[model samples]
Target: MSEPSTYPQPPRRGFVLAVVAAVVLAADVLTKIAVVASLEGEAPVRLLGGAVYLQLVRNPGAAFSMATGMTWVLSLIALSVVVAIIWMAPKLRSIGWAIGLGLVLAGALGNLSDRIFRSPGPMRGHVVDFVSVFAPNGDFFPVFNVADSAIVCGGALIVLLALLGKDYDGRSTKEKAKAGSSEAPAS
Candidate 1:
């Protein structure tokens, strides 16, 4: 009889991940474009009794407006994140991990695309940001957009899954090892 193959097959999770990433990127880009077109050179639009507001802003930095005036450095970091996600996607067997990473990837790519192609020079373009929350003290939260939201959510999910002891494929690593051992042929 022919020997049985031991190599594992590629998981379908990667395809799902890619699709989710694409959707997120598309949504982020579309929303940014809409915000820019609607609120260009306009004042902030108050919403939710001033607890929330829609204001257009351009960020030339990372999250929470950090590293201002370092657009190239931020662009490099974003590009690196996207590359890492793409490289890791195929190896992820867990749907949860794939989903989380996909979201992160999409968000990174969305902002990186803006940095590469938007106004100003390459890798020095500003990211379009909107959606702000206000405190009772009249200070506004840093403006952010869908891409930032996805990135944050994805990062949170990754932490959650790790804390739950789930592997990249959503199975506990111990469980997977036990299952594999059980399936092995006796010598």
Candidate 2:
């Protein structure tokens, strides 16, 4: 009797990754809603003895507020990311890949939600940014939101995984060869 092959394959399910994406998206959306509600008319609320501040601002542009009048283009880009992630979800096997891609999905969907449902118009709305990390002169860093943070972290993780020679299928070359040899019929 022959044993089952040990070769890696596309996972039958990616619910873990989906859950991660859901959590991040929920956090991003909920935080943005809360910040908009609480910090609408109030001054910047400092926390951690001034290390962090919650200052509500609307960004109608890309990172660092660049391309200030091109929000629709940015929304399209985010939508593409969302579509790509959904297409790639079925093949996710490695935990690291799942986490990375999940964060990316979350970030994309989170901001896309804002673009679709927030003020101004559909696909032309501003993203709500409330968290400002550090400021030596009060204007050094770009104010960012949870979705942006997730995207950055997820991208970094993907880069790190690549540098470590990890693949999405979770199988090294040697394992593939062994699995292939084991599946062959003997003379």
Best by TM-score: 2
Candidate 2 per-residue C-alpha lDDT over 18-134 given as tens digits, one digit per residue, 9 for 90 to 100: 998999999998999899989998888888887888888888888788988888889989989988888877877888888998998899898888888888989888889888866
- Candidate 1's error at 174, in angstroms? 3.3
Q: What residue pairs clash in candidate 2, if any at all?
A: none
Best by lDDT: 1
lDDT of each: 0.84, 0.83
Q: What stretches of model 1 exceed 4 Å from their correct place?
A: 1-10, 135-138, 176-187
TM-score of each prediction: 0.84, 0.85
Task: Judge candidate 1 against the unseen true structure and give its global Cα lDDT, from 0 to 1.
Answer: 0.84
TM-score of 1: 0.84
Question: lDDT per residue, candidate 1, 1-187, as tens digits?
Answer: 3344354644757887898899999999999989999998887888889887887888888888899889999999999998888887767888889889989999999999888988787999999988888732125567888899999999999899988888775567676677777778888
Model 1: colliding residue pairs: 93-169, 94-168, 94-169
